[model samples]
Target: MITSTTGLYLTAFLVGLLGGVHCLSMCGGLVGSLTAGLDPRIRRDPWRMAPYQLLYNLARIAGYATAGALFGGLGALLLQLDAFQIMQRALYALAGVVMILLGLYLGGWWRLIAVVERAGAHLWRRIEPFGRRLLPVRTPLQAAALGYLWAWIPCGLVYSVLITAVSTGHPLDGALVMLAFGAGTLPNLLGIGLLAGAAARIAERVWVRQVAGLLVIGFGVHALWSLFG
Candidate 1:
């Protein structure tokens, strides 16, 4: 159960750390495209490419934390209304339920999470063209701007952890939770952007994703138990 601020942050981080393995396939193409957009000079030199990649991903993480803050604030605001105390509990429970389903989605045992993903796909489609406008990035700031837009890109993993963030009912705590989650993903996504071929192979392996998926499932179970246990 994510009863404490630190526990929530850790849970969010674990979700991103373990679940990010799946994003290799989902976001690898985007990472590739982002890299490919860079000048050939940067592509040829690993040192030059590092800063741009880091900036882009950091901006993306900022977007995640921003969303978490907004949603958490909204949740907090809602709680100010009468009879909303129970609603807060419902939100937390819903977070746990969605998390379990997301794990199943990650594990390839179910596709229920796609419903959530699809719900936002339209909004993502609208936001995606903005990223295209920044292609062939000339500066780290430009890449970072593109990343900020891409943060809203639809993905079950992001959405799963975001739901948990919202349930925190505090803007700062929610932002912190998402920040930790984003940090967890930093390693994997940065690795994928740097080593697409190797990351692809690892992502393609069935057992690798399954193991990571199971851990995510366990997190969901733990979250639920924390609520009721």
Candidate 2:
């Protein structure tokens, strides 16, 4: 489904890896919280728990695909509308700024990023309870569904990618781009969920977070420059 040039594919992969890194901190809690109910015996069994973790991640990826498809379709509809270019560029600029703010937040420069995320609070509240109901998820399918639903939680990283996807100007392409982005995170998420303590320790390091923030901010700046230059 991904047919981009080597460079674009590599870029998508790198972005996915970065997204995974961001999730290392934010998503670890969710994964831990979800897996907390497992029997000590089950938790100790890597073979059984591993499948659940993989399924949970796949579900989340599916969610990204769904979002990508929806946004891509929206972009397509917008393309047919009058003044779509102007609207698209406006969205590009806005998304870029949001990414910059997200980077700053990641860098520990501000705490207000939560406020931007809270804009989706109402929807999240509605969906979150449903996710909780799937708690102590035993089956891979259940874990996947929960993960998919959880993917919609307000995340600046995902939003940044969404903005990039929409700017591609084709709904199918947008969806594929997001899928590529999601694929990029597989390694990190898979590893972190399985090795919680180590992942958390690595993510908590100041230098690691700062480097990630800088990379995201650099991307945001580049996006802005591309739009206005």
Clashing pairs in 1: none
The regions of model 2 sitting more than 4 angstroms off are 1-12
Model 2 error, position 132 (Å): 1.0
For 148-215, candidate 2 gives per-residue lDDT tens digits of 98888877677777776775667777777778878887887777767767877877787877777777
Candidate 1 accuracy as lDDT? 0.83
The window of 10 residues in a row where model 1 has the poorest summed lDDT is 83-92
RMSD of each: 1.3, 2.9
